[model samples]
Target: MDRIRPWLILVGVFLLQFFLSELLAIRYYRPDFVVIFILYFGLFFGSYYGVIAGFIIGIFIDMTPLASYFGLSPMTYSITGYLAGHLQDKYIRWSPFAFHAAWLCIISFHFLVFTYVRYQLLFEVDIVQYLLRWFLTMTYTLIFLLILQFFFPIKRIQGA
Candidate 1:
C-alpha cells in the first residue's frame, strides 16, 4: 500500500483537477491543483521522484483533450518539481525569509511561463493582460497553498 499511496494521490488529484477545474475557473484564473501535488512530492521525496512525478502527471494532463499545447505542461511541471526537490533538505539550513522567498520565486516562475506560453500562441496578448493573468493565477494558487499550510505546513522532519 505504501508503494501505491503516492500513485493513488496522483490519480485523485488528476481526476479532481480534470473534472472540477472548470468549476473553479474565474474567467482565465484557476487554481492549479496538480502543481500543488507535484510540489508536495518533490519537496518531500527529492528531485528524482519529483521530476518523474511531474513528467508523468504532466503527460497525463497533456493527453487529455482539453490540453492546448502538446509539451508545455510537462515541461513546466517537470522544471518546477526539480527545483522544488533541490530545496527539500536545504530548507532547514536557510532563514525563514529565504526559504519562503525561494518557493515564492519557484511558483512565480511556474505561473509566468505557463500563462505566457499559453496566451502567446493563442492570441497576440498585450503585456498588461499577460501580467494580469499570470498574477491572478499565481495569486489564486497561492491562496490555496496558504490554506494548505494551515493544515500541513511544508517543513522538514527532524529524523525521517
Candidate 2:
C-alpha cells in the first residue's frame, strides 16, 4: 500500500491538472500542475525514478486530445524530472536562495522549451509575443507552486 500510494497521488495530480485548469484558465493560459508532482517525485526519489515518471506522465499527456505535438511533453517533462532529481537531498547543502533559484530555473526551462516548440510557427514572426506567452504561462504555473508551498512547504519535505 505504501508503494502504491505515490502512484495514486500522481494520477490524482494529473486529474487535478486537467479539471482544475479548465476552471482556472485565463484566456488560453493554464498552470502546468502535473510538473509539480513530477518535481516532487524527483526530489523524493532519484533520477532514475524521476525520468521514468516524467516520461510516463508526458506520454499520457501527449495521448490527450489537447496535445499539439506527440512527443513534446515527454521531452520537456523528462528533462525537468532529470534535473529535479539531481537536486534531491541537496537542500541542506545549498543556501536558501540557491535552492529556490535552481527549481525556478528548472521550471522555467521546461515551460520555455514546451511553449517554443508547441507554438514555434505561430509566433515565428513575433518574437515578443512568444516571450510574453511563455512568461505568462510560466508565471501562472509558478503562482500555483507558490500557493502549494505556502500550504505544504518543501522545507518539511526536505527535512523528512
TM-score of each: 0.93, 0.95
- Candidate 1: list runs displaced more than 4 Å: 121-125, 156-160
User: Candidate 2's residue-wise lDDT over 1-160, tens digit each?
Assistant: 9998988987888788767887899998999998888888888887788898899888888887768899998888899889999989889999988988998999999998999998897578899989989999999998999999988777777773
**Residue 70 Cα positional deviation in candidate 1, in Å, after optimal superposition:** 0.7
- Cα shift from native, residue 28, model 1 (Å): 1.2
- The most accurate candidate by TM-score is 2
Query: Which pairs, if any, clash in model 1?
Result: none
What does the lDDT read for residue 155 in candidate 1? 69
Off by over 4 Å in 2: none
Clashing pairs in 2: none
Scored by CA lDDT, what does every candidate get?
0.85, 0.87
